[model samples]
Target chain A: MLPEENVREYYMIRDIRDTPKALDAVVKSLDGISEVAASARKFRKIFFIGCGSSYYAVLFGSWPLMKNGSVLAFALPSSELILHFSDAVNSDSLVVGVSRSGRTAETLKALEICRGKGAYTVGFTIEGGSEITGIVDEPVVLDIGEEKSIIMTKSFTAFSLSTAMFSSILSERISGEKQTLIDECKAIPSLARSLLSYEDKIAATSKRLLSENIERFIFLGSGPSYPIALEGALKVKETSYVATEGLHLLEFRHGPMATIGERLTLVISCFLGENTVHLKNFVSEFAGKGADIILISNSIDLGESTLKLPPEYSGECKALLSIIPMQILAYYYAVGKGRDPDKPRNLSRYIQRF
Target chain B: MLPEENVREYYMIRDIRDTPKALDAVVKSLDGISEVAASARKFRKIFFIGCGSSYYAVLFGSWPLMKNGSVLAFALPSSELILHFSDAVNSDSLVVGVSRSGRTAETLKALEICRGKGAYTVGFTIEGGSEITGIVDEPVVLDIGEEKSIIMTKSFTAFSLSTAMFSSILSERISGEKQTLIDECKAIPSLARSLLSYEDKIAATSKRLLSENIERFIFLGSGPSYPIALEGALKVKETSYVATEGLHLLEFRHGPMATIGERLTLVISCFLGENTVHLKNFVSEFAGKGADIILISNSIDLGESTLKLPPEYSGECKALLSIIPMQILAYYYAVGKGRDPDKPRNLSRYIQRF
Candidate 1:
């Protein structure tokens, strides 16, 4: 490998390690969350919009509002919002656009269109004075510092946590009830810090899997973990240049399970809720079909392959933590295959062109 | 091949050919659609719930209600609704459950939960007096005859047309304006019939592509065509047992574009609207990467590989028509690969368990 490749890989690993610090910074900077939540309560419909990894984060963030069945929250790709669903944004709607660079062209255009429609717009980004800050009615800028790697690792977790914090506060304000999830969100930084200690183990696991010559990867998650699965798949695809897919846990069984074979690897995030038993059964079924299974969970233990997370975190908190190991796996897999994780082929930091 | 496999393949082809007939029956049986639409006007939010192909169908069906920006319409997998988002269903919500068998376990359970929460329930099914019909308050049972094949081809199109019809009626009722799409929908059966004349051409194209030994397939669509892209991917995955993925048109550029290379084939649904130029540019970029491109469009043509649809149809109408070629492609691809499209591995007609 070239000396420059080594330097770029170091940047990716450093970004992965800096996740907890980034989350801590974002958590400490939540002064305007309640006011944003208050304004969100007035809107009948709320849209969380972003592109790529940011889209997955906003999808995770929109979960709190969706779980109560009262607020109608939709998380969409910014391009979809601008081209197709722009008619859905009206005066009674709230739009939240999340981008690490805060200058994703589709997101900026989406925010501008929503603003023109008289919808309340909020921007979430690590950059304080980027284009999105000026386009949105409210800006929740995180002072999490810059990420050197082209792939989003620290900002993904930070943005998801920030959006979840806002959604949880909004849910509480709407229901006139106190929420404990916000407190759990506060504890996520330390949890993420503790997870950083498992980097060596994750790297070893990824190297072992890479040695297997797996041709395809499938990630599955239920509920809030669904978007995490998507982010995991994207991480592997962009960094390692492998064909990977993320789907809702049961949605996999519907048709996608047919792809299970000797050269396939499955990474599943099994939540400790209603679908736990089913998730286990499905994992065993995939394993029986000769596919390798790497199960990530907070509670369920399925022998040696399960990457057990720190228990007692809520679904949202677990969602935030689950992507860390996946990000590490993507990093190591890229390095194992002699690819640079900092600069994946055919991708830029953010899409600025139409 | 076994004689039984041949018989099953025959059934699948017959079902594909019978699509127009089934769609004609569904379009003719819209007697009580206005009543359902009028009732939907009272609800603040609407959820379209289904499993597998039904899920994608309802997603296409939900586009009309989603487009006006007045009503909040969401299409979710039944398992997601029952396990994750049940709390979002309430008295002010209207839930529409769709199943070809009318006995999908998750769909039935979701309907029951929503009904218990006082949400108005509607069920779209080909099977009358099935479990879903008993569970939902309103049953829009199409008297289209049974599908002999395990894969849902005719029923998929029929259910999507029915849902789109209902959604179009609801949008009109809510906005107090006439929808030309509904009139365009009424003309779909004839269009589908006319398109079937090109089956031999579609089969030749599929066989030619299969001969290249493509390793992966990606389908991309925008607006109303997005769910069609997903359904196309599902059809290829379930029928051919190949690794296939479907995503929004621009979402492909985000990160998944890394997978574009020599053994990759892409099927894109390009509407002749705002994103046409961007879609063309992306297609050429992928083509430059040594991937085969199949452009399915109503207006735009990109040389020999473009599968042009009959012009003058609305986006919704074009979405309904685009999948026919994909269905035919999946059929021939399976047959050419010595696999039976009638019964794909690891899948049942309806998921009754969990």
Candidate 2:
């Protein structure tokens, strides 16, 4: 299927194939930590730092690192890193700094603090010799999918994709899954190519999704899907400029669901926790309330026009895939409204200086 | 001070004083959480639960509890109690449930799960004889103001005020400051009344704030002020529907400073650790960037309007006090826009079903 034919999972597939080199470069470059890998796993914990979309990637990425047997992994925004929290980073701590542009002031400051605290430091940045490069024990330059327009598209996905592969590598090193990880990661790019062939169809589906004059957007998922829900809402909020909210499927019933109606656009992430049957029921409940549903999952039970991501990616991968459609959905939604898709009205990609 | 006062800090003086029996009457008429209260004090860790505004109240209130030695505490939404994080709680855990109506479905459900797990539970509500009472070992009800508005005016403050007092009470138990707790709490109503007496002035000040037509809104405070910044943003988000954001003064330069203009409205909380001089410099930095400044604290040294609350609170109390002006700011902004303060167009105080 092509982007125009399926119109559901196209961007997701394209995103997978489109950002491979960036992902591969990051993996190969950041593999060493001595001059850059730091004091031989010297930290008690690895704190991944970023904000907004980057913060989200760190969150999802933290899961795999947790499986690496380092449960102390935490994702925090660079802003929070500098503001209230202390370097509570001991000499043994490792701070993995992440930024697409490599210029976000807080990330630079955080790297400075990590080094100042005599802790291990490493960074993933798009630009080499940027301020971030000078502050690291090892700096991995990943200039993947650099975007000229402000709102992050290719860069965000590439960064997250690279983090995923990195997590797999870490998981392999610590959890004894080396062979499987190597095999899987090697297959990812080709798999991504297969997915991209459906871009035309996903694009068509996205156009249909934007046809409704939706004033309210509610996105739902569970487990790892939780972060995807947040990202989905963020994409819509920053790009489409809509009143969007993201919450776990069941959590919506807690209080936010009271605002649901025909005017609302409800997006559900299907590749969720082990037991998504209840989530399916939760989606049905929304349907009962006259809300439209957009399902993105590896499973087909999510109803018609579902974006069936390849089976190789489930669980957290399902969550990763969820990001693609929402990105395209927002991109298409923005252009349809005669608004610029590249540079949203009140937002910037780098958030420089302020 | 009257509602129209330009003075800041409206403690629940008049309202609480008008209903002296609120503490005892409400406590006795409802149910007492004597058993849970007694047992909860012995937990290794405690978790507070609620939804939306109520959920945020627990987050803001938890810091004092943390400082007092319940260092492993977490404030979670009731809806999340059993879904994604049921593993976090068990028979050994202590749980506090907070809700304005006392009957929030998710809160009740969460309480049921807690009791089912044999975890000790305390239920705080504005009314009695509901699911919360049925599920909790002890239920504390304070029906002080029957908040009629859907947007939750008096109820939000009442919850924050009562929770602060409760935390102070618990803090006293931990640090043997019971007498001080009672004395301090007893003094709040008068402080609130005195502040309320200046209501007319605040309303006038708020009128000017709304008229400023500031292009951006930035709130600053340290420590507990971080949560006040969150609450302030939540209020503004729900009310005037503006793109308002809050950050600690320390992190003000992260990225938000780039968009500063005279049209920017900078609300600075000046109580304890206010960093007023730094804040003035901050405002000057923004003014240099052409951003306007609005000051709110126990005191303000220069420029813009000063929301001067009497220095009767610190730590969490400062947070409790700091919220007053922002609430007024949101309320007046809503009123100025001719939007109903009680009922915003696309929102609900609670979402009863999925």
Judging by DockQ against the true structure, name the best candidate: 1
Can you list each candidate's DockQ?
A: 0.66, 0.15
Q: What share of the true interface contacts does each candidate keep?
A: 0.74, 0.07
lDDT of 1 by residue, A65-111 (tens): 87865766889999999887787788989999998899998899999
Each candidate's TM vs. the true structure? 0.94, 0.72
Lowest summed lDDT across 10 adjacent residues in model 2 chain B is found at B7-16
Q: TM-score winner among the candidates?
A: 1
Clashes of each: 3, 51
Please provide, for model 2 over A200-230, each residue's C-alpha lDDT reduced to its tens digit, 9 standing for 90 to 100.
Answer: 5666666676675564577887656766777
**Cα lDDT of all candidates, in order?**
0.83, 0.60
Worst 10 residues of 1 chain B by lDDT: B1-10
